[model samples]
Target: MKPLLSIWIMLLCGIAGRSFAQTKTSTDTVVKPPVQLKTVHIVQYNFFKDSLAFREEYAKSLTFRRLKWYEVYGGLSVNINNLYRVTQFKKNKKKITFKHMLLNKEQEMFVSRVYTPSLVNKVTHLDGDSLQLFMQHYQPDYAFIKNASDYDLYLAIKKEYEAFMKTRDSIPVQP
Candidate 1:
């Protein structure tokens, strides 16, 4: 019985040693390359042209996007400032400026579309410096253009052209 017990203990020790040796040899034989980390580039939305929906989406992504220390500081400062009335006024001013810029651009586009050089030329039969002079002098305001129909605009241009022709010689031609 003592011999049998000794044999069982030796067998268990041998099995454990073999398993440990096998694991060690397996780990030693396998070669792993050093991990190479790739640089990640994050792109933020354009502030000028971004729509409200896009702004909302971008704000939602703030949690995942990694920002620099200064960027984080600046953002927090701006957000905190937004809670106060004085800082809010500054934001409102910026918005007003942006709105005015957009309105001005729209007005310019409307003027270009309705009071085109071609339309003026066709109406006046004038060319070169005189045509340019007439258009500049009689350039309709945004409000007038907005309120006037196509026919009204055409008649107005024709009438203005006639008036311009009468005083054509009187107006000084810029060199």
Candidate 2:
């Protein structure tokens, strides 16, 4: 390559590197909520969030090696389409495996009303059972998501808007 071109390339590389390093250090980072709720307080909170986003567009192809959130639980932000055809759930603890056709989708759960003072110690809640539950419930779904995408696998997250309507009469809400 010409010397002038090479010099210009070096200058551009240096500028790009410096700008990237500075931007990364200065960017604002958003923090997520600490996980672990024995019973979802406002059961509708997460259910509502996902219900709003369930239907953007399903990608026809998937590149994941495992299932995602949509496979086990339905939520608004998850894509649902082709996944219903081949989704499977393997419960390692119980030594039970479930396929889409085998899962008993007819689940009946009442929202457990928790009565706790807001100022109670946070320390008691952080322990083994909560961690296990967290792993049992959330880790696998994320594991699935980490491996898969819209390209091949397809599944729909339960839309939030309708979820409330479907369960509104069933679970009494606190005003």
Error of 2 at 19 (Å): 1.7
Which numbered prediction scores highest in TM-score against the true structure? 1
| CA error at residue 109 for candidate 1, angstroms | 0.8
Q: Where is the poorest 10-residue window by lDDT in model 2?
A: 106-115
Off by over 4 Å in 1: 1-81, 85-91, 172-175
Model 2 lDDT tens row, 5-112: 999999999999999888885347768799996975565445333423322221111112355545644565545553653454443212232222122221111011
Cα lDDT tens digits, model 1, 1-25, are 9999999999999999999887785
Model 2, residue 161: displacement in angstroms? 64
